[model samples]
Target: MKTTTIRTDLPREEKRKGAFMILTFFGIMATAGFLAMSIDLGVVAVFKVRMQNVADAAALAAAQEISIALDEISDQISSGNVQGEVQDANSYAQDQARVMAEHVAELNGMFIDPQIDVLFGQRTLDENSGEATITWGVSPFNAVKVIVRKDNPSQTAPDAKVDLFFAKMFDNDQVALRAEAVAYIDSRDLVVVMDFSGSMVYDSLWRSDSIDKLGQQAIDDGLYNIWTDLDSPTYGNMQFDNDWITIPSDSSSSPKVSLTWKKSTVDITTTKQLDYARLYFSDNKYQNFSSLSGQSKTLSGTGSNSGKLIKYAKVRYKENGREYYADFDLFDYDTLKRGLDLNGVNYPYPSGSWNSFISYCLNDSEVNRAGYRYQFGMMNLVHYWLDAQMPYSSTPELWKTRHYPFNAVKSGGSLLCEFLDGLDFGDHLGLVTYDTYHRVESQLVPDGWVSESVDIGATPITDDYSAIDTIQKHKQAAHYYNTTNVGGGLHEAIKLLDEHSRYGSQKTILLMTDGNANTSDNNWSVPSDFSWNAMTDYNGDGVADYTTSDSHKLYTFVRVKQAIDKGYTIHTMSVGANADRDFMKAIAFAGDGIWVDVPGGTTVAAMEEQMLQAFARIAANVPPPKLTHSESP
Candidate 1:
C-alpha cells in the first residue's frame, strides 16, 4: 500500500483472501475428523461381528456339553445311582457346560470372566411360524445361552478396554460392544426292533462266517482234534469232542449216538429225514477214542420215526498192517475207507487211508501236547449240515446249550437299554421282538410305571421302561429263540410308534438284527402271523416298492420308507457276520438315519462293550446345533 495508491478497496481484497484461507483450513480439519469417525465405526462394527461369532461358538460349545452332561446323568441313573447322586450329576453337568463355554471363548481369543452368566434353560419352537422362544431358568435345562463383550468398568464380569483405532483426538479412546447366542435340542420317542431267532442261540463253533476265526483259537486252546470240514469258508459244523465212547464188552452192540431233528417251535408238524451220519475218531491219537484194533461193532438205533440207519459197521483199522485207534476200522457210509473192503458190513464209500476222507480239512494230530487240560476240552460242536436240527454228539457234552448269535443279541440289547436309561430326557422307549412273529415286550411309558406289574393283564408287553432295569426286561422279552421275522418286527415297531408316539415329538426306530430278513417259501420262513404289509415308493418312481411278491409283502426296506413317510427316522445295527449289512445300510439311508455294524465277539463282556458303544452313538445322535439367538444383547 504505497501512500500514493493506498485505497479502501485494495485493503478489503487482501482481507477477503485471508478469510478464504481460514475457511479452507477449517474445512480440511472437519473432513479429517469425519474420516477418523468412519474408520472407528468400521473397526467397531467388524469387532462386534467377530464377538458375535465368538458368542455363537461359545453357545454351541456349551450346548454340546449339555448333551454330554445329559448322557452322564443318564449313566449315573442307569448305574443304579440314587436321586441325590443324580442331582449331583446334574450339577456336575451344569458346571461342565460353563467350563466348556469359557474354554471355547478362550479359544476364540475372548477372555470372558467366570462371573459372566452362561445361562441354561429351555427353548420351545413354534410349529407354524418356525420362530423359537427361549425361557431361561427352566428345569432339566435343555438350552444354553452365552454372552460376550469388550471390557466394561461397571460390569461384574472382568473388565478390559478396546481402544478405538482412530477416534482418540476427540478425547474418546475406547469402544464397547456385546453379543449373545442361544442353542437347544428337541425331544424324541424311540421304538426298538430286535431279532430273536433260533440261529441266534446256535453254537458259535458252527458259525460259518470268516469272522469266527475260532479254529486257531480252538487249536491253541487245545479243544478240538478233528474238524468236520477243515478251512472250509462256509459250513455249519466245527464241533468235536475227545471222549471216545467205550466199546461195550460185547462187540456186536455198537455205541450209538442219537440226534434230535425236530423244531418244536415250527407251526407245522415237520420232521427231518437223516440221509446219513458220520462218526469220527482219532486213529493216530487214541487218547479220547478207545483203540479198537481188530474190533467190529454194529450201531442199531438212530431213534427217529422218519429216520433210518442205512448201514453201520466197525472193523480192524490196520492200514496195511498199521495198527491205529483200532486194529480194525468201521467200513460203512460213515467210516474209514479201506480199499480191501474186509468186513461183510463194509459198503461202497470214499475209499482210501483213514486220512483219505479228512485229508482236505485235516489238522489235528498232537492235540494232547497242543495245550489245555486232559489233552482236550470245549468239544461237541458238530451238527448235520445236510439236514436241520440233527446234532451228533459222541458224548454227554451235547446237553450244554451254546448261545452264539442269540447271546450277542441279548447282551447287546441289554447294553442298548442301559444307554437309553441314562438319557434322563424322559424320552419314551418301546421294545418289539420278532422271531416267528412279533411281540411288544415293553410299551412307550415312563420309568417306574407300576402298571407294568399290575396292568400287565391288559397286554403281555405292558412292561414300563424301568431305566436300567430294562436290561433284565429285555432279556426276558428276548426269550423267544425261534425263527427270524424281520419284517414282522419292523411292522410291530412302526405300529407302536404310530399309535403311541407323542405329538410334535421326534419319532425313531432302532432296528437291530443278527441275520438276513426272513424270506418266504424257504426253511427260514416265518409263521402265518408273521405276514407283513408294506407301502412305499422309495425310489420316487411311479411304481410302488411294495408289490404282491413275498419279498415285497414282507417289511424289507419298504418299512423304512413307510417310517420315513410317517416322520420317523430309523437307525439300524447289524450284529455278527450273518447280519444283512447291505440291506440294513440301505434302510438307514432311506430312513435318513445311521447304521452301526458290531462284531460277534467271543466273550459276552467284549460283545457287550462293542454293543454299548454302538448304542451310545445312536443315543447321542442329534442334528447339528444352530443359533436360536444370534444378536447383541
Candidate 2:
C-alpha cells in the first residue's frame, strides 16, 4: 500500500532532496577554495606593496646619498685637477657610492634589513656613471630589488619594485620594486646680503614721535639685543649720520664695512672728521659795540699750521666767576662768528670745535671770502661740539680743512638724526657731517671703489644738510615717515656699495625710508653706465639692461653699483603708503637683498624682528658644509 502510494510522488521529493545534497557539497567546496585563493592573493599583495615601499625608500635614500657624495667627490676632483694631480676618478666614485649606501642604510629603520649592492657601471675621461641596488626579502620566498643609477654628466632614475607573494608560485622568480630619482650638484657660490641699518634699532623710543630720546638705557639694551641677534659675523651697517663702524675687526672691510656709532674704535679706521675753527668776536662786537674796525693783529699758531701769528684778538676770554665770556667792543647784528685761533690769526673755518681759545676781531680778509661768510655759523657750532665731546686730545691736523672734524670724527651725531635722514645718505656723509665737513675731499667717492656712480649731481641739495635744525625735523617724525627724497638715498647707497666691492670684500647695503622714491624722471636718472646689475654676472651680462624709469628709477644701477663694486648685498625695509614696492623688489633683486614691508610703521620691535629674520636667512644660506656618510660597492 505505502510503497504503492509512494511510487511517483515520493519519487519527486526524494529526487529533489538528492539534488539539494549534491548542490550543497559543490557550493561548500567552491566557497572554501575561493576564500583560500583570496587569502593567498591578499597576502601576496601586502608583501608586494611593502617590498615596493622598501625599495622606493631605499632607492631614494641611495640616490640622495649618492648626490651628496658626488658633490663632495666633484669638489675633491676639481681641487685635484687644480693642483694638476692625475687622480683615479673611477676609484673615487666607487668609494663615494659605497660610503653613501652604507650610511643611508644605517639611517633606515631596523625593520628593513636592506642589502645594498653598488657597481661602477662606466666611466669616461671626464665623467662617470654608477648603479646602486638595494634588495630586501619580505618572506622566505618573496623579494624586492631597487636600483638607483647615478650617472655623471647625466643622472638616471631610481628604480623600485613590488612583489605578489604567490607570483613566485607561477615562476621561481621573486618580484621587483621600482622607483626613480635624479639629482645634481649645485655649482654656484651663494652670495648673501644682510641688513645692518640703525632702523634695526631695537630699543624702545620715549617720544617715538620725537628725537628727545627718553629711555636711552632701554635703547642700549635694545641695541645689544639687536647686536646679539645679528646672525652673521659678516655684515655691513649704515647709520644715516654716523661713522661706518664694523664689528669683528678681523673680518674683511672690502665691501664698505658699515657699522653704526656703537662699533669699537678699532673697527672702522676712517672717521668723519668734525669741523674745527677758532671763531673770533671783536671786543666791540662782543660787548654791544658796533662795526669791526678794519685792522691787522698778530697771534701764535701751532701744529701743522704752526707759524707766526698773522692776526690777533681785540679781546680775550674773561672769567666772570662761573661763566667764561669773551670781551668784545661791539656785539652787532651784522657780526657773525669769525674763524680765529689761539694765535688770534684768522683761519679757514670748518664745522666742529676749534682747538685755539684765542678770540679775534674780524679783519677785511674774513668778509672778502665768499664761503666763509655763509659757513661761519656752522663753523662755530662744530668747534663747540667737538670741544665738549673730545676735550682731551689735541684736534687732529686733518681738522684744518674745510671739512675737517666732520670728516674725522668717529661716531657722529645722535642716532635719531641718522635714521631719519636715510641710512645711505648717513653713511655717505659719514664722518663728514659728524665732524662738520672738514676733509670732504677725502670722502669723495673713490674711483674704483664703486661699480657705478650715483648721479647725485642732479640733487638740489649740494650743501650739507646736517644742521641740528634739519636733523631735528627728521627725528621728530615716525621712524617710518620720510619728508625727503628716498630715491636719492637709495641711489647713493648703490654707488657706495659698488665702491666697497672693489677691495675684494663683499658688502651689504640697508636702506629704510618712509616715502616712495621720487617718481620724477626730470630730477632723477639711473646711472646705467657706471651701474652694476647685481642680478647679472659681476662682470655685467646675465641680467637685463639697467634703464632709467620714473617708476623704477630710485634704486637703479647708480645706487646698486656701490654694493656690487664691493661685492655687497643690500637689504631694504620700509614703511609708507607711497613706498615703491616694485622699486624695492628690484633693489632687493639687484643687491641680492630683501625688501620687507613693516606693516605697522617702523616700530622698534617690528623693525628689529624684520632685520633679524633677514640676517638669519642670510646666515642659513651660507651655512658651512657638514659631513655625512653612506654605503658603497
Off by over 4 Å in 1: 1-54, 66-100, 103-111, 121-142, 149-151, 154-179, 204-212, 215-402, 443-464, 467-481, 520-555, 602-605, 626-633
Q: Write the per-residue lDDT of candidate 1 for residues 179-285, one digit (tens) a residue.
A: 88887666566777877665554334333332243343532222222222222121112124432212111223333222211111001010221122233233321
> What are the per-model numbers of colliding residue pairs?
20, 104
In order, what lDDT does every prediction score?
A: 0.51, 0.30
Residue-level lDDT of model 2, residues 1-633, one tens digit each, is 355444565556766787899899999878876775676667656655554444455444443443343234322221113112112322343354445544553454212322344332211011012222212221110012233322222112232233334444445223343222222111111112111111211122222331232233443333233223322111112221212212221224221111111211111111221111132322212112222222211222333334322211222121222212221211221111221111233333232323321121122222222112112222222322222222112222211221211111111122212221221111122111101001111222323322222333332122232432132221111112212344445444444333322221223445554344432223554555653344533335555543444543543445465555555566655443334565566666676766665432333444334433332232212111111122211
Quote the lDDT for 534 in model 1: 26
The candidate that achieves the highest TM-score relative to the unseen native structure: 1
Ten contiguous residues minimizing lDDT sum, candidate 1: 261-270
The weakest ten consecutive residues by lDDT in model 2 span: 431-440
Question: RMSD in angstroms, candidate 1?
Answer: 16.5
lDDT of 1 at 600: 54
User: How do the predictions measure up, each by TM-score?
Assistant: 0.51, 0.28
